[model samples]
Every structure is written in structure tokens, then in C-alpha cells.
Target: MNDQKFVDAVFFELFDENFCRYQDSLTKPTTGEQDSYGRARNALALLNSAQRLDVVEFLRVVIADTASVILGALDGVHFPDGLEGECVVSLDGVEIQGDLQDMFLSKAQNLGIYD
Candidate 1:
């Protein structure tokens, strides 16, 4: 798949998996907290709709912006040449090794989050 499609797939997979875990962790919110939990559930439901592309796009932007800041902080670290094995990100059981900032920025640009 192309970089943008690949990144989008990875993003959605991660979001779906993590969001389910998050919902599980709540394990039935109390009466006072039900509204908040219900809202979250409704949001997820909306994301499943074809009409909610705008919501999905907005979420992608938010995720990319947040990830950029986190990954940008690693820019100052100097790794030895032989230490490449230590840096890897597993997406769909495949280990990808590269400069994460560059990878993320490229994908973000593909998403039109940056000019």
C-alpha cells in the first residue's frame, strides 16, 4: 500500500484496538458518570458511519498534531550507528525501523495536515 493509505490503516487499527480497551477499563460507569461514558460510546458509533468523515478527519489531525510533539522531542537524542536495532515500531506485527519523526511527518503531510 502507499504511504498515506498505510498510515491511515495503522492509525485506524491502533485507535480501534486501544479504544475498545479503554471502554473495557471503564467497566460500567457509575450513574453520575453514565452521561460521559454514553457520549463516548455515541462518538464511536458516529465514527462508524460513512457520513462522519469530517469527524474522522478532525480526529486524524488531532492525533497527528499530538504525535508530532511527542516524536519531535526525540530529535535531540544521538544514537550510535550499531544501535539501530533498538529503535522500532510494530505496526500490524511488522517491525518498522526508521526515523520516526520523518515517517510521521511524511504521513502527516500526506494527510494535508501540513503544507
Candidate 2:
């Protein structure tokens, strides 16, 4: 909700897509997981100090969207009656942890956001 958070979010969004796009271009180690979100957040930690408002605006739009919902879902999910659970799903032959991705896709579908 804050400017830094907004910029961080945009950075994450872009980082995520770029990571996926160039995945095959990068070499992988057998021991570590990709810190994709961490990379983006680190890139914008001082966003409020920056002069540009574009990244902040982009983060606002993104977080106001299903992507944020997905992140929330990834972290945790609550039902209408207050039930909660972890969610995951298979999409395009890849297993997506539905906890966040599903929540994101569902909201995006409702909002008509898609690839």
C-alpha cells in the first residue's frame, strides 16, 4: 500500500516474467531455489526515495489486481465462512501452488486479465 511496496511489487511482477522468459538462459545449481520475489523487492527497497512515480503507480495497479490476491492466497486463503487452507493446482503441465497462484488466476479471470 505504500510507495515502496508499490515499486517493489512492480519490480516483482517484471522480475517474475523476465525470470520465466530467460529461465533457460540461466544456469542452475542443484541446491538453491530461485529467489525471484526477493530479487524484485531488493531492487526497489528504497523506491519512495526515487523521483519516479511510475513504478509506484504500476505497483498500485498490480496489487489492486489478482496478482496481489494470488500472493495473498499463496500466503494464506480464507473462505466465506472463515475456513482457510493452502491451495495449489496444475496449469500448463506445471504445478502451481494454488494457495497464491490459484487465488490470482481466479481473480484475474474475474477481472478479465490474462495472457
Candidate 3:
């Protein structure tokens, strides 16, 4: 996929899936969680208009930078010693395996976000 498409796919994977999960967890949400959920819903709504391009770009940068930090921290460590060979990470119960950005992209692709 092209760079823009890849970015959009990753963003959609991150945002939409988490949004759904958070919505599901609001059955007995605290006040803070309820407020946060409201803000998240509003953010999702903003994506429908032209004014959200900058917001989307900003979120992309934040996601990339956050991924870099997390992946960088995991670089070159012995799995058995540091990660205990149980380092499996999942999104929505789907296994995701990779070092950094690949992890997120792989999940995105697995979810057919690129399609």
C-alpha cells in the first residue's frame, strides 16, 4: 500500500477497534471513563469533515512516536530472560507478533484495514 493508505489503515485499526472495545466496557463505567468515552466519540465524529485532516496528522505522529518508543525499548532483548517467552500481545483477542510498527501494521492488515 501507499504511505497515506498505510497510515490511514493503521490509524483506523487503532482508533476504531479501541473505540468499540471502550464502548463495550461502559456497562458500568466510572464518571471519568464516561467523560473520556464521550470525548473519544466526538473525536471519531470529527473525522467526517475536512477540518480533521490536521488532527488526523497529529494523531498519526503521536502513534508513530509512541510505537517507536515502545518498540525501541523491546529491541534486542533476550525473550526468555526479559520477556519470559510469554510476550504475546493481542488486539481484540487476535495475536499480533512483531518488534515495533510492524506489530501495529500486521494487526491492521490482519483486520483487513488495507482492503
Best by lDDT: 1
User: Model 3: residues >4 Å from true position, as ranges?
Assistant: 1-34, 40-48, 76-115
Clashing pairs in model 3? none
Candidate closer to the true structure by lDDT (higher is better), 2 or 3: 3
| Ten contiguous residues with the weakest lDDT in model 1 | 25-34
Evaluate residue 47 in candidate 2 and report its C-alpha lDDT on the 0 to 100 scale.
57
Instruction: Please tell me which model should have the higher TM-score, number 2 or number 3.
Output: 3
In the range 1-115, model 2's lDDT, one tens digit per residue, is: 2323433444455445543343323222223334774454444444553422444334434544535554555445533345476655434545544245344445445544332
- Stretches of candidate 1 off by over 4 Å are 1-37, 41-52, 77-99, 111-115
Models ranked on TM-score: 1, 3, 2
Ranking by lDDT: 1, 3, 2
Tens-place lDDT per residue, model 1, 6-114, is: 5555555545565345546434333443466666545555454453444444555676666655444443234444443244455566544344556676766765764
Per-model TM against the reference: 0.40, 0.24, 0.33
lDDT, candidates in the order shown:
0.51, 0.44, 0.48
Best by TM-score: 1
